[model samples]
Each structure stands twice: as C-alpha cells, then as structure tokens.
Target: MTLLTALLNGAVALSTAKIPAKRQSLIILILLIIASANSFLHLWFSEASEHSTNIFVTIIASGIVLSNRAHWTASILFNWVGWITISVWLELALIQHFFFAMAMSTLLSWFAHLARKKLVTKQIELEIERDLAIQHELEAKAATETKSAFLANMSHEIRTPMNGVIGMIELVSQTELNTDQKNYLATAKRSADSLLIIINDILDFSKIEVGELTIEFVEFDLEQFFEELIHDQHFHARKKGLTLALSKGDFHHRHVVGDPYRITQIMNNLLSNAIKFTESGGITVHYDLVTLGDNLQLKVEIKDTGIGVSETALPFLFDSFSQADTSTTRKFGGTGLGLSITKQLCELMNGDISVKSQLNQGSTFSFSVRLKPPRQTHKMASKPPVPVSFEGLQVLLVEDNEINQEVMLAILKGLDVNVFIANDGLEALATLSHSQRLKFDLILMDCQMPNLDGYEATRRIRAGEAGEIFSHIPIAALTANVMDSERVKCIEAGMNEYLTKPVKIEALKSVLVKYHKQAPAQH
Candidate 1:
C-alpha cells in the first residue's frame, strides 16, 4: 500500500513539475500541502476498518513530501512509520496476506541492493591485489635475470686475465730461476689462484639463483681429495704462520660416490675462511662416520682459532653478501658468498650444516652428508708412463701479435720441437705451399689473424691447397675463443682439436702427443 501511494505521488509530482514556469520553492510548498490534504481527507472519511485508523494516523503524523538533502533523516523516519501503518491497515481492510507480501518485497529489495554494492567493492579489492602480485613477480624476475647476466659477464672478464696470469706463471716455473725469483712467482701464482676462487664463488651463487647449478654423483678417492685440499691450502696457512691440521677417521671404504668438484669446493671455502681470519692459532678439520642401516653419513667439522662472529650475526651467516661484521670484510677481503655457496652445496647433496662461535676466540662449522660406498671393480694394469721428447716434431705456429709469437717460440724452443713461424693464416698457407721438403706435422693456427683466419685456412688446407704431403696433417686450433660453440666450429671446419689461450705447457704437450701418435696412421 505504501509503495502504491509513493508511486502515485511520484507520478503526480513529475507531471506538475514539468510546467515551464514552475518556481522551485512554490513546487515544494504545493507538494507538501497536497500531501497534507490527502492525509487529513483519509483520516476523516475512512471507515473504521482494520486499515482506516492506522493508515490515516501515520499519513497525517508526518508533514513533508519529496524528501531532499536537508530533510533525509526525517524522511526516513516518516517512511518507516508510514510503511508500517499502511501495512497494518491494508491487512485489516483486505485479506491480511498483503502486509506480509509487501514486507517481504521491501526487505528483498534492500538486501539485493546491499549485495550488489558489496560484490562490486570485493571485485575492486581483488583487482588491486592481483595487480600488486603481478608487479612483485615482474620485479623479482627482472632482478634475477639482471643478476645472472652480471655474474656471467664478470666470470668471463675475471677468468680471461686469470688464464693469462696462471698460464704465464706455469711457463715461468719451468724456466731456470733463482730461489728468490721462484718464491716471488709462487706468491703471485697463489694470489691469482685466490682471485679465481672468488670469481667462482660469484658464479656459483648466480647459478644457484637461476637454478642452473647441479650436483653429480661419481666414485672418487676420498684420501686423494683431502690430500689435494691440504696441499693447496698449506702454503696459505704457512704464510699466516698458523698451523693447519686434518684428522681422519678409519672407514672400510677409500672411495665414495659424490661430486668431487662440489665437495672440494665446500672444503676449500671453509678452510680458506678459517685461514683468512686466523691470526695466532691453528685450524683443524676432523671427520667421523655415522651408520644408518645400509646408508653411511659423514660428519666433517672445520674449527678455526680466528675472530669469531657475534651471537647477533649468526642467524644471517648463510645469507649471501653477509659477513660477521664490516671489519671482517675490511681485514679479510672477500665478497662473503663462499659460505652461502657452501651451504647451498651441502643441502643439494642432501645434508645439513651448523656453526658455533665465540667472539675473539674461535668458530666451528660442521656439515653432514650421506654417501654410498663405491662398488668394487677390477683394476686394469696402468700403462707405463712414456718419457716425452718434442724432438723431430714439425710444428707450424700461426700468430699475429709479436709478443704472443715470441712467447710461443720460447715455449716451443724449451720443448726442443722443430718450429715454423707464420704471422698469419695467409703466410702459413704460403709457407706450406712454398716449402718442398718442410711438411708440418701439426699446425697451431690462431683463430683471429690478418688476411685469413684459422677456419678458412684449415678449410683450404683440407681442400689440398698445401698438396697431399701437408694435407690431412693434424691442424690443432690455437685460439682464445674457449666457448663450447667456438670449439664446435673449429671441429666442423676440419680442425682436429681446439685449445684455448693463453695456452699452458702441459695442455700443449698433451695435444702434441695425441696428434703426433695419430698422424702416422692417417698418413
């Protein structure tokens, strides 16, 4: 009933307010007076039915119509009173079922409006949350890619110089030198080696972040592994005048299954850190064995007498780029990624790590890993080691740089090989074609050179431009392009082997021996 009245009154107001000359204040006053007149007429003329008294009483009780901004509160109160009054009166005047129907319709309309508003608000909130999550994911992905690229570029830059330094050092060590000169060379070599290790740590951390690093299981001699570690670090410890010791536990097995490279890396990191901070006391590594049915676990502990970490810093010890303190980083120069890599490696091997420390006293780092005992196999008789002599071997050295040429000549001269020099691939081809009696046993062709490079020259040589005498002779690539794709290109170009610069004497010797022995069968 109330709804019917409101619709009727709305229609009346719309029709009257459409007049062009209607004044706003006069419209409002006229609406109020009409509403009041209708209320009083209903009260006076209605019969004493169930709805008569209630509907009339409520309509006459309020004095306003067309509720506006300033009258909204009073309008709401009047609407409720009028609605209840009309509902009661209609029920008495009619079948009494209309009251319940009206009430339900009004309640349903209010609930539907509220539900629509809530759903729209929820949708807006969900949109904001999804946008925020997507933004965070994009930021994380960009940061990860950036870190990977930086580590790759950094590794290449650092390793290039290190290759030169270490190669030169190896060559120098074989030369005749006094005791003092040899000591200086050794020190420089050690420093270069340490720098290489730091570079590797950065690479490892980056690999871990990008999910590219992996561990392999293989059989290796545990004693030999430890021996190499101790030998390598003994010099560093001695330089600091600190005692380095290792204690071994007796096990039935000498060989175990695990990645020797990753294991050595972990031990190296722990030992290096221990020696780096130790000033006056010793460092010790102890091992023990734990058995669980068929599986064996090894517990390794590295204890050092060094400036230990504070209790507060222990929680973040395994976090990347976190050192015990800023002073530790200053005194012992490092990027603080070693322990982080070590911890990651341990977990990859299905192991756990722990640490204990006291300030100014010492620290002990321990890790445990499970290992399978290596299966026994029949040992083949080892080949008798052959004494190497580069005599009677004909070598063609193609290089563009004068310093590099001299360096190569010096190394070859020491090997007692018959060496032929070519400044470029063009010269090398000319030499091979012009000489009637001098046929090269092996060509060490530089990849980048004037006139022609190693690839084209090797192609021409294989095409028999050097005559059948020099054709098919092993052409080993002597280039600085060490990437796997570069090596594949050399092989595809008919070169027998690829060697990266700055080349080491041992590697060069191995290549010589391999080709020299294989050359006879090819001819």
Candidate 2:
C-alpha cells in the first residue's frame, strides 16, 4: 500500500505544472483516489494503519496547491475530502478521533498557505512603492534644474534692454528741459525704477532658493546713515502726501561697521510697504542700540498707519511670494518678495524681526541685529567727487547687443576714456592679437554671447592665447547675473574685476580708477 501511494504521487510530480489542464486534473484525481484507497487498505492492515495515507495526501495536496494556482482550490478540497472519506468508510476503533485529527492538520496547513501568500504580496507592493518614489525624486530634481535655466535666461534677456532704458534716461536727464518736461521725465524714471525693483525681487528670491546670496559689511556713520535714508525717501512720501520722518534712537556712537546696503534694503522694504498701503498718516522710523543679555544689538523700528494684517495673515506675512491676503496682491501690485527677503537678510545678519498689527489700524515692524561696537575713524566720511574722470584711460568693450553697446559708449564717453568695440569674444581676441599698435587698459567683457562666452575668452587670455602682452590685461565681467556663483566663476576664470549690468556710472568709475593706476601708460 505504501509503495502504491508513493508511485501514484510521483506520477503527478512527473506530469509537471505545464501539463494540459484536463490531463493535470485527471492526474490529481487519480492521486486522490489511490491515496484514499491506500488509507482504507492500510487501515484494514493492522501493521500500517496508523501512519501511511495522510502523509502521502499532504505531500500531494501541498505540492499541487503551491505549484498550480489554477487548480489549488480543487487540490485542497479534494485532498481533505479524501481523508474524510477514509474516516467514513472504515469500521475501526475510535473512528471519530481519527476524523478529528485529520481535519485539524488540514486546517493548519491551509492557514500556512494564506500567510505565505500575504507575505509575498506585501513584498511586491513595497518594491513597487520604492520604485515610484525614486521616479518622483528624479522628476523633482529635473524640474528645479529647468526653472533655474529659465530664470538665468530671462534675467539676461530682460536686463540687456533694461540697461539701455535706464542708462539712456539718466543721460537724457543730464540735458536741459522745461519744468513740465522734467516732471514727465521724473515720472518716467520712477516707472522704470519700479519695474527694475520688481525684476530684482524675482531675481533675489531665486538667489535665496538656490542658497547663493552674498552679504558684506562696510563702515558708515550711524548718525548720517539715518539722515540720508530718510532724505532719499522724502520725495516719494511727499508725492504720496504722507509725512516721512525719523523718530529718536538711543545711540552713543558716530562710526560703526555693518552691511549698509542690506540695512538700506531692509528699511526700503518696510518703508515701501508702509507708503504703499497708507493713505493719510506718515511713517516714523527709529534707530537704537539695545543690550540683549551679553549681546549688544542694533535695533530698528518702523511704525506706520496703514491697512494692517489680519490674524489669519499675520503668521505668514514674511513667507515668500505671500501677502496679507489675495485682495492685498490685487489692490497693491508687487511680487510679495520684499518682506520675505528682508526677514532672511535680518536672519543672515544674526537678527530677528517681528510685527504688531490690527486689521484696520496700522503696523509696527521691529528688527534687532548683532553688530560690532563702534570704532573711531581717522577722518569723517566725505562725499565722493562729482563726475570723476578717467581721461587718459583706454577701454576695449566686448558686448553683443547694439543698444547696450550704445549705452556703454555714452557712459564711457562721459568719463573721457578712449574706447574700442568688439561684438563678441572671438572678435575681441582677434582685435587683441592683431592690434600691435594699440593696447587696451581694460577689457569690459559681457558673459553671455553667441559663438564664445566671456569666461572662455578670459581663460584663453590668461592661458596666453591672445598674445603674451595682452594676456595679463585686466578683464572685468559686466553681466546682469548677480548670483554669487557667477562672481566665483568670474574669479576662477581669471577675471580681475566683476561688474553687473545696467552698470552704475559710479561703479564704472571705481573700476577705472583702480585699474588705471595699474594700467600700462596710455594703453
């Protein structure tokens, strides 16, 4: 009986899972019949009754169920029924006990199959989830890269023309005009300036996102700084029919070192917002030195009567590209980046900012920053000389845009410099290589252009590809990209100075003064 059971089950294994459906069914049925017959026959035989049939049935049932998913139900049910059949057909002692033992074993094995199936299914789900997460991560990185490229391109395209507009407006302002004409010109200039500020806000936010903003500290008179800042904004407040003034501050110093530009930026952001929102009342500003524990901090406060923030909007006031409400954006036009930039600048300078406001009353903003104690300077700060000249200097201007070239030429002419023009980096190289009779005191190179770029041209010049005499000539990158990476890139590519586009006449003169002192005589 044992040999018959083993041989019959072995035949089912030999019929591999690939056997025809009907044939597979036939084979499993035959194993079931023979296994049951073996159980009955063994029960009659006193020697083997205890051990034979159920073991063979378990092997046959589990193997078929695991290997053939299509027939597993039949395999499980028929095998269990086969054991029950044995219990029923036999007239033996303790028949009920035999039936109960077989039923419990079959129930335990079926539960084991279900647990294994669930474990396999869960593993597959986890692997699929991991793959999808990797895909999403890759997509996010690609999107960030795309946005960066778009911003860089947009900045260049916009600033190239902006340089021409603002530069020409300044040049035109220098000429004679009637009172009304001057007023119209002032309005035009203000409009252009406002547009420039918007562009800068967008660019600044981009810089912040990429973690490339730079900060620097300069020495200035504490007394004079507040006076001048108020004076500069007086015209705007006057135009709006709002009084702008500085309240008193508790300070005992004359000269201190701090980031004056950033300080001015923070002040401008707060003051501008105040002026924009206020209809009647004036803006009051205070500068003070406060002692906070062991740290001596420079505290500034601006109070204004304006449309204040609601409780819902107060917490998110400093969030980037966010305003008090959607209506705030619609009523007052702005990119909503100024206050966010101000908050970050405060933090960058080791400070914090806060606001107190009511829905209809007004707002007061306070900022405190850590700064070094004042030190005495040898001389009081003096005003820079008006319309400084670089009369004897010679400059080679490399640029692609015609309007930008004209703008630069006009500015350089005012400085009394003898200028030469090259439309691109290659032309500049060729000019330097061939002009033995003429040498340049400085090369003002633009970063982005067709054919070749400023970085490669500067690299080649440093590598001695543009003749040895011209190789060491000063190259200043005049670009619109103000990102910190661009500055580092210029330095690494062998540039002596870096300047941004819409190049301020003051900045240009500073560049000329420093370079012309080291400039070859009349080159």
User: Top model by TM-score, which number?
Assistant: 2
Report the Cα lDDT for residue 300, model 2: 89
Best by lDDT: 2
- TM-score, predicted candidate 1 vs. hidden true structure: 0.59
Ten contiguous residues minimizing lDDT sum, candidate 1: 60-69
**C-alpha RMSD of candidate 2:** 8.4
lDDT (Cα, tens digit) per residue for candidate 2, span 83-110: 4555455643334545555566556556
**Estimated TM-score for each candidate:** 0.59, 0.72
lDDT (CA) per prediction: 0.71, 0.78
